[model samples]
Target chain A: MTEKDFELAGIRTVEEQPLRAKRKWYKEYPVVSMLFLGIMIVECFFCEQIMTVNPTYMDLEHCNVAPGRKFLFGTDTLGRDIFSMIWYGGRVSLLIGFVATAISTAIGVLFGAVSGVASPRADAFLMRAVEIVLSIPNLLMIVLLQAVLGGAGVIGISIVIGITGWMSIAKVVRTEVRQIRNSEYVIASKCMGGSFWHILWRHFLPNFWPSIMFMVVMNVRTAIVAESTLSFMGIGLPLEIVSWGSMLALSQQALMTGSWWMILIPGCFLIVTLMCVTDIGNSLRRDSNQRQSNL
Target chain B: MSEILIDVQNVTHHFKLNRKTAICAVDQVSFQIKKGEILGLVGESGAGKSTLARCIMNLYQPTAGRILYKGIDTCDRRQFKEHKKMLQTKRQLIFQDSTSSINQRMKAVDIIAEPLRINHVHTPRGSARAEAEFQLHYVGMDAGCLDKYPPELSGGERQRIAIARALSMEPELLVADEPIASLDVSIQAQIINLFKHLQKEHGFTFLFISHDLAMVEYLCDRVGVMYQGRLVELAPTRDLFSNPQHPYTRTLLSAIPLPDPKRERNRRKGVYDAQKS
Candidate 1:
């Protein structure tokens, strides 16, 4: 086909794909995601009350129980119901995950757009600065941040993770913006004497939206997993805070004794929640890629 | 044709690809476009026609030399912004690739009226839409085209929208850079006819850039033939066509095929070859 036909086909695909994919997304994933999200949100608000057998009010009387009626998912070695800990643990893990991702994504977009649209000298300088930040190992720096902050609790850990995690998304946005700067629409806008912000809003951002969606979803996954990993390493959250990683940290010794509830319950929740997040992200990726290829 | 519309003198554009390398795209190009005259610039693909058009519009900064619009030095640092606004209102450019030049996200009406909106052409916002409708009609598009996006329109329709947009400003001078290059020959003819009609009706000054010598001959008052980065020769359209001076111009002109199959079949008698010239 001719280039015009190709472009015509491209515009059709771009226009049509989003509506169809959105329908598909809701049909296949939204209900399930809503269910998972509902459960998570419920846990966040009422973890204390829903735990029927409150985790703090340990029952030494029913110690070492397994998947029984009175204490569902069984009781831990200390007789705290494992079910309650899992729900409460998710509160901090999921919170840390989302909050950090948000902070990092905001930082990423600002720096990325700046780097992308800036002059060559400024772009080089900004990207080099990004490179320097990216060069440092993520986990190592988070550990250092934790130590330096002296157990700054959930808030501090989230801030630290957010600060460290923005580079990749920033780089992605920068590259996308640079590509956008060359497109005919941008050149046309420049010819029309559009200001920097006008071009960014009208041309760059609209075209960059799909990719940004994908990056945001992916970053959510990274931030959540990183928080969990930090908790497992025993350096992410404070000892007082209950998180999936903190539970895992406490379960290490119990693993040798074969009392796996402490480890098994929280780990399962982490895996399940992460799986749901990845599914949402995958759908977003497919949607964005479909639109991107059309362009 | 008495007063000069655009004065481009000794202009050069050197693009630095890297810190250590640069390429001169336009070298010491001097030209004048008189009021109510269409000055056609014809050249090979890399002959800097588009670059010259861009420089004249102040869309690009030449490495050296200056452009004057009604005697205001457009390249002057302090006056660049002042002149740019004047140029934007009184002069405009229509590009080769219609699809690329028009924003896909915008409706045809919005695209046509964007210049007016940016420059605040009308007092109230609603009147801009009216002006846009008027422009679309001016370019022979119906009122129904106002709501349609660029992606939904055909190439010819899109170019019409671009022309409408450029003409909406009611510019005294319009630089058309290969405006018909991307269209089919039939559509190219129609657009050319429209441009000629508009020019004659309004006495619009034009800087028409194209590789199509026949189209240039049909439309322009004077034609400048460029090869590489320099103007090889320039003359009135008839003189340049009938008594070509530059070997490059002869090479370009000789390539145009005769319309009649009988004559075209035997038209290859004394082809101008560049290497021998």
Candidate 2:
């Protein structure tokens, strides 16, 4: 018989109308999309303020200016606008955090899924390697790597964080892959003479989506915090780049002189941004849990 | 003399526990199912009936012996791949727990249409949804079920949907592995009767594996008794029940509590054994 004539006699099909209804919630939430849109808009409009500020423009004339029409949210000892510094500083921090998290999560999911689904012998070997990497304190490993790399720019620090951050996500994804590989539908696909690659892409990946999503959101927050810590320690992006971490670092000397704007503005921005991300991540996690429980 | 649809010869399957020892799940079991015949494989939980079914479906490979489908040897790996689509189209399995067997994430129509899509059966002419609905109606379900997931349906309804999925492929043979064993006892008869009605209308062979001999006796044309990886007896259903050759078969028959208290009391007294002799 022609390929078209071979009916896989027992597989069921869904009617179009109901499938749309079943998938309605994914479209309705749009939380991730909204966050992404908000980030893009802020980045495009507010990134110019950091470059415009003359860090050495010691405006002794307007130093320590309180919240006023001329200088909104007051001026630092160096006479930079607190509001302007926050908007610009936020751009680099968010960029590094998201990029690092994306890189780490992608590496983790791919490696974990492959190792988990590979032959048992291969899986054992890969898992041992993962365990070794995980045994090292993550922060120490990133610090050591940054020291060795030396040029510790934004890209360099991001690479260091990305490499260290993937270990935990790999472990989670490996566990998920092991569980999904044994599902009946996967076995059924193998029985139907599907290729290994086909099964991996079609069955394994789709089933791994929920876990991958959870890992991605969790890792983004981790990356943001890790970037801040590194920057505070003088190992993150170039000293010239006005990131949240660099802002915090610059504010330290001024703190003794009690120019609170140096520390308070960047600190508050970091807290608010982290809170927003955490809220969205927690909501996604809750939704995933609810969907699983309902199933 | 019906045409032979499936011929399983000396199929001995073993699962390796280690280098030295193996679990003999199905040991040299042989049977032939004829077109339109319902061959009941009655056994206890560990009797290897399901393993034999899996081997026939190519889900599990037999360590030795061959399964011949319509005179073609199916045990050859190359031949199996070459004829994979044909095998799937010609043979299907209905698992015991309808809810677990059907994908919970999939809607009823997509579950039914999966086999058709996989085998590329719905060429240019028929829509998967239309074919799914037709098969659902064939198993006494309606269009409403198409929109629902497996979790949303009652046990009987889910089983019906499973049956519809199996029937959609238009297979010549179906391996129904304890299809109704998970349903409510009240719904068991309805599902059993539905299988019977479908067999009558579709004229497909069935290898019905179950521990319930009474249901098997009512539904099967021939019956095979399996005990601890061995087929102890194989005969026409009437002959097997009325004149059971295997001790296990006799035990199964005697254990069926008669509906009448008087008859049941007499059966307890070994009166049925005497009558059988």
Candidate 3:
């Protein structure tokens, strides 16, 4: 066979084999996977409908209407559909959470890999800088940045959360990189005259994935919660954006009037989404630990 | 005498801790492995034999001096890369702890084919499985082992696999760094015999570094004695054992318990003094 043909044949043979054995937990608790998948699908479908509803659209004729045929979740204080507001608000929250976390993780992985794999002098300098950033309270840093940026909109909040969220991920990645740098395969690669980028891409990055995954899962929840807090404090997004926190903020006056639907519906959706995300994260964490112990 | 294949000259390696404390791991160590000859390096725990082997392999950059392959410096990256195929095809290493050295995640076939893959030897003719199977059989393993992971094998099996992997590279010089140190006593003999057999059959030179003097004497043509990172004596295996010149070498040899129980019992009284001889 030709060289290219042989290489292709060899690669195909190797790739055909399964990389890891299927874990017992996955088989036993198939519902967990289904639940996570179902939630994701529902969230995706619902989020689009949320933006379509005019959260500020008032219907004086339908004001204070209880659960009825037209509005399943009933009308809010503003005469808007509570269900529609939730779909839109959840879209914003989920978007902010995922996008911000992704950006931070990418930054963290790059910084951490470079710092951990570089020489001692570079390592010390980078680690000290990481330490300084980590020492700052996350919420305060976000708030300070948000204030300086002069807006509490989606873009501003995302930027603030993304920048500050990376510190924790960077620390985790740095620790993992330091440990993997000394592995035999890495040393072997060096002996084979492999370049630094080659070593980083081939060896360090693959091994760094499990931790990065864990960090992403954990950071999503943090970003979501931070965004909610900023929004609740009247500093995130425009007043028109119908977020859960904005709904809560709007409900404070209506709570005394016994219009409980204003707060309870959005609040429940937020709680459920957070809980499901946390469950998935916890499962991933358990899987990671099991894999490590097996190793 | 066979032509000199590897010349390690005045190589000194020190592990520096801050400015004040520096531990000299290999101090001006020098040796040569002739083509198609087995040269054993025997020493105690802190003897720097492994460090010397690592320096020769260019895994650890030496603090001073040179390691030459066919009289050309092996330390230059450009020269090393230019002769990459020669280096990968001509030199291989068998580590002390075979299980730890081989990537546990990789299958037996992949582990054996690693050097070939890295050196791009199998690129043009990528029959890694065929080559791997051949080497595995050479070391008494079958194609069935190709699918197995490192953790699935016994210590002896792992070492055998390690040896097969090293030999598969078609190395002219094999650095067996305490290849049997982690194996059982019964298994050690089998591995030692395998090394000897492979050397004879393949006509490959060997630099066997080990703490076991007896094993070294049994397998090597020439033996070198190392103490505190320095080679104090070098000669033919039998000659070095019978007429050791260095005090450390004499102490080391004298401390080896004789096989006979009666001789061992009688020598027990002088054993400690022998260790200090």
lDDT of 3 by residue, B129-239 (tens): 888888889888788999998889889888988888788777788887888888889999999999888989999889998888789889999999888888988999889
Work out candidate 2's RMSD over C-alphas.
12.5
Quote each prediction's TM-score: 0.77, 0.77, 0.78
Best-matching candidate per DockQ:
1
Lowest-sum lDDT 10-residue window in model 3 chain A: A6-15
Q: Model 3 chain B: which ten-residue window has the lowest total lDDT?
A: B268-277
- lDDT at position A166, candidate 2: 93
Error of 3 at B241 (Å): 4.8
Kindly give the stretch of ten consecutive residues in candidate 1 chain B with the minimal lDDT sum. Answer: B268-277
Q: After superposition, how far is residue B251 of candidate 3 from its true place, in Å?
A: 4.5
Best by lDDT: 1
Clash pairs (backbone) in predicted model 1: none
lDDT of 2 by residue, A1-295 (tens): 7975676878657566644345665554656645764774476356674334544345677777766787776777666666666666676777778889978987897789888888999999999999999999999998899889998777777788888899888888788889878766666555544566666666666667776676787777788788888888887776577678887887677778787777787787787677667766767777788888877
In what order do the candidates fall by DockQ, top score first? 1, 2, 3
- Considering the two chains of model 3, state its CAPRI-style docking category: incorrect
Clash pairs, candidate 3, are A50-A88
